[model samples]
Target: MLSLRPGSSGSLAPESSGAVIHPSAKCLIKRSIDILGALVGLVLLGLVAGPIAIAIRLDSPGPIFYAQTRYGLKGKPFTIWKFRSMVQNADLLKQTVSNQAQGLIFKNENDPRITRVGRVLRKTSLDEFPQFWNVLRGDMSLVGTRPPTEDEVSHYSSHHWRRLDVKPGITGQWQISGRSAIRDFEEIVHLDLHYQDIWSPWYDLQVIVKTITILLDRRGAY
Candidate 1:
């Protein structure tokens, strides 16, 4: 089991208690799984990506991609790619619209910036399909902590920053647990740390299976 300590500011504390190294066998196995799973997903999705791209282009007047700066492993910065799901300049327009979710994160179920095709893509989580490429490129894993935006990264306390110690992931404990339903940033950090402490190839496989169910049910996604 993992330990959780309270930070000086009362938020969660970073796992500064020294590194808990995973077995080399576990690390190699997990990486192999990530590579193989991502490859298969990319091949399968490739067949459908063209039609989706066309749909997005027809429904919106913006570039086909949405790239945002996100924090990756060890708190490094990387750009995360997604099929553009919002209108051009959506980032600039975020402040002008009313935010629907609680805490530091922003989520608006009826965000005006979303295009018609974007709504479909978001509902099916097709927007995230592009991230498989990130996994292949080694910027992300098939499962781990969801990468935070650069702005969100800035607000993290040292404890919250523990999520950055590992690679940013396409999906993780948070996504399988509740995703947008889990509103507290502190709770999110706690879950991410839990993952870091107990990570295994089997755990990743379990999360992937659960994610498929969650996607099909579409619970707590938005």
Candidate 2:
């Protein structure tokens, strides 16, 4: 469980750390790991991706991949990619449906937009594989906070904006902890800010390990 620290004005500090370090060095180290890890993961998964792409095409009528605009470091916008896991018109359909999760996040276990293949991809988290390319491109890190969608960003308070102080990530504390199970927007913001406050190369490693375990268990994955 994450322990929250109190920031000025009753805002949550989000993460625990014993000391502060130079932000530049931290950025360099984190980027180096992202590049190295992404390169290696791509190499190892290269063979696997081809068949997965074919399966997706066979299972769905749309493109094999999907991309959406998301907020990255310092609130910059970038396109984040994933395997197409819903009907081509899913976004257009969302407005007509009732959302299942609380606060600014939307999650419905019974969402009708999910394609047949999308269910498997989401369960295994294979949909997120393309983001390694984003990591390589420096639009993201291997670990930090999950990038918020533009709609989600629009709802952020000033305290929540603190999450943008670091690059968005492929996985982070919230992911490893409970992911979609976390319904409160403030809790998600707290997790992101926590990651920023205590970030380090070692912390990245820890989060990655936890991510692997969470993925294997397939817990809290929609």
Candidate 3:
């Protein structure tokens, strides 16, 4: 299993993931762009949040948002927020259903826990709006790697933990490539670490552009 140690300030210490992810000037540029994009998203959220919340309430008996613990930069824990797209007891129901995906991840294309409104929220990616708050709060980047749940992290081999060297993202290569259709978890790690290796402001912009295209086309998204 991967090892992690908390920074003195209670954040992730730089060396926690067993590799030094050198901070670059381009990284700072990427951070600036993230802030701008997140601010716009939060403003948009203010307009759509009420309607989405009401729809969720009418379709399901659960909280408007689902906040789950996930590992962010350097395997640090953070709660990722999304519009509730599953039943209240969805987490508890995980083990009862056999996983349909490969390599330690649980995925079911037809998971019964999904709500009526949830299906729409997921396909159009509206369930991702709440994560703008996380981006604004600096818990995530606008583009990077996907965040993994603590349970998923717990099972990661040390090499797999390298993906956590950078901040997680609301959209990335994985989402744009195959999104929920991806089966092998290794494919995801490959793309994420590939991003880590070739990360640049231009690349991030490219990924963001492709992500918009994917959202509009609703390709491969659940």
What lDDT tens digits, residue by residue, belong to model 1 across residues 26-75?
38787898899889979977988899889988887888888987767655
What total of clashing residue pairs does each candidate reach?
Answer: 1, 2, 0
Error of 1 at 128 (Å): 0.6
State how far residue 128 of model 3 sits from its true place (Å): 0.9
Candidate 3 displacement at residue 98 in angstroms = 2.1
Off by over 4 Å in 1: 1-26
Candidate 2 versus the native: TM-score?
A: 0.86
Estimate, for each residue in 1-222, the C-alpha lDDT of model 2 and write its tens digit.
334554544333335422333372256777788999899867756866898889888987888889998876656678899989999889999997788777778888878899878998898888888898988998888887778886776656556666767777889878987997887877888887777778778888999999999899889987
> Which candidate number would show the highest TM-score if scored against the true structure?
3
Candidate 3 C-alpha lDDT tens digits along 7-92: 54454433435546635223779889999999999998899999999999999898999999887876778889999999999989
Number of the candidate with higher lDDT, 1 or 3: 3
TM-score comparison, 2 vs 3, better candidate: 3
What order do you get sorting by lDDT, best first? 3, 2, 1
Reference-based TM-score of each model = 0.86, 0.86, 0.92
Worst 10 residues of 1 by lDDT: 17-26
Q: Each candidate: what lDDT?
A: 0.77, 0.78, 0.84
Q: How accurate is candidate 1 locally (lDDT)?
A: 0.77
- Those runs of model 3 whose alpha carbons end farther than 4 Å from true positions after fitting are 3-19, 22-26
